[model samples]
Target: MTNRPRIALVTGATQGLGLALVEGLASRLSPADTVYLTGRDAGRVARAVAGLPATSAQVRGELLDVADPDAATRLARLVEERHGGVDIVFGNAVMRIGPDDDPRALMDAYTQVNNFGTTRLMRAFTPLLRDGGRFLVVASSLGTLSHLAPVLHDRFDGLSSLDEVDKQVAAWRDAVLDGSAAASAWPGFINIPSKIAQVAAVRALASQRRDDDLRRGILLAAVCPGMINTPTSALWWDVSTAASPAEAAVPLLDLALDPVDPGHYGQLVRFGRALPWKP
Candidate 1:
């Protein structure tokens, strides 16, 4: 590893879980470490960075929209130039749920941001993620196998490659557009399916990295922080029983900071505990 400080990046960090994760990470940063807080809006990124508590490690803000491949590439280049490489990447950026009346539009929006956007980031940043690094995808419990149709669940559970997962997501998108998603027993909501694809992609990446002849030693994981009461979530859920963003971020922080355990690779973590993988 280079003598430069270890680096961490969190996307969509203006508010809610992303912001909370940034705060949790700030407290744990070593003097040599630096954290980058990124979002689509420059103004929001600045405000979020300014509000963070003082830390030993430097905290900086950058503008990033995960949906843009050029933006992902630019961020990767910037990190490589400044820090040599990143030690941790928190993929927290997500799209808002659109109106259900337009199923096609809704599916397209979620797929772009939640699925394809994630693929872009992973592809761009994998080269820049130092050996023995961590890539944590912020997923949700709604993506669990229990929520999918049996056929879809089997396909996801048996995923062997990222390409296969990508194909599945594409198929789902096509199904939605053709109005055959319900016939396939797929849920109407876009969030759950999008997250399901995200988790599967994470699993595929972890498996690929581990089996590669040139191992990167990157630990990949998908985490569900539960129903946190964030501004985005507040619109749909009652905040009464929902955990605060800070509270929900605890488990994510633990996973990011902790040593890479091979057993946890490719796992879906809920509140810091790894759930059993279905064969």
Candidate 2:
């Protein structure tokens, strides 16, 4: 049997880092292998798939809005039916807004997409992972636990259940909506908390499913791709010195395609190095 994975999927692959991830996977996999380039926008997904080189792995576009509760599940079912299972799944979809936007709106959007979206995708796809498969949450350095207050440490560390994470995330959201988030030590910017929740979800689910993971050789982690010059990043800060999407995608591709290391599972990784969750 060939060593190359037969199926790979990347979400939010319409542009920027997501698009580059699709490119990297397509180039790396054999022509017989398939890479699904998914995004919420049908037009964008179709265009992104059309633009990829036909000489590489077969690239197919699918409309996937992670925020929609049923979207990930539907795709998972379809993938399992067609491919039997998937080799790699990159949860790269996220929602971020400019600092000038209303804080409440940002919190709501971020919670739904970045937080809930991640957990939903994990639940849907984790079971479909083939042996030696990798499921990655495309998080960032901001997702680190150090960004959270010291008081919140134990709530996230070595979580044994996703429900524990959800309760904490919901509490944070309540703090935000009640205008007490800042006073309560939740980050003023909604992105940080949402990312923290995303990472926590990954950690929790990885722990919760350790038995199945070990049995199937599945690997899970939240990865930081570093600062990339994408349209979204350009909105909040000057990305003049930031890496291009292609450059940022390299480390992530390495983690997804390289050999699985159990040590890296359930951790926050940057450039193949796992970062400490605690300060």
Q: What is the lDDT of residue 247 in candidate 2?
A: 97
List per-prediction Cα lDDT, in the order shown: 0.81, 0.85
Give the candidate number with the greatest lDDT: 2
Question: What digit string (tens of lDDT, one per residue) describes model 2 on residues 51-93?
Answer: 8765478888898998898999999999999989898899989
Task: Mark the 10 consecutive residues where model 1 has the least summed lDDT.
Answer: 210-219
lDDT of 1: 0.81
Return the lDDT, model 2, position 127: 85
Candidate number with greatest TM-score: 2
Off by over 4 Å in 2: 1-5
Residue 248, model 1: lDDT of: 92
What is the Cα-based lDDT of residue 156 in candidate 1?
77
TM-score for each of the candidates? 0.90, 0.94
* Clash totals in order: 0, 0
Measured with C-alpha atoms, the lDDT of residue 163 in candidate 2 is 79
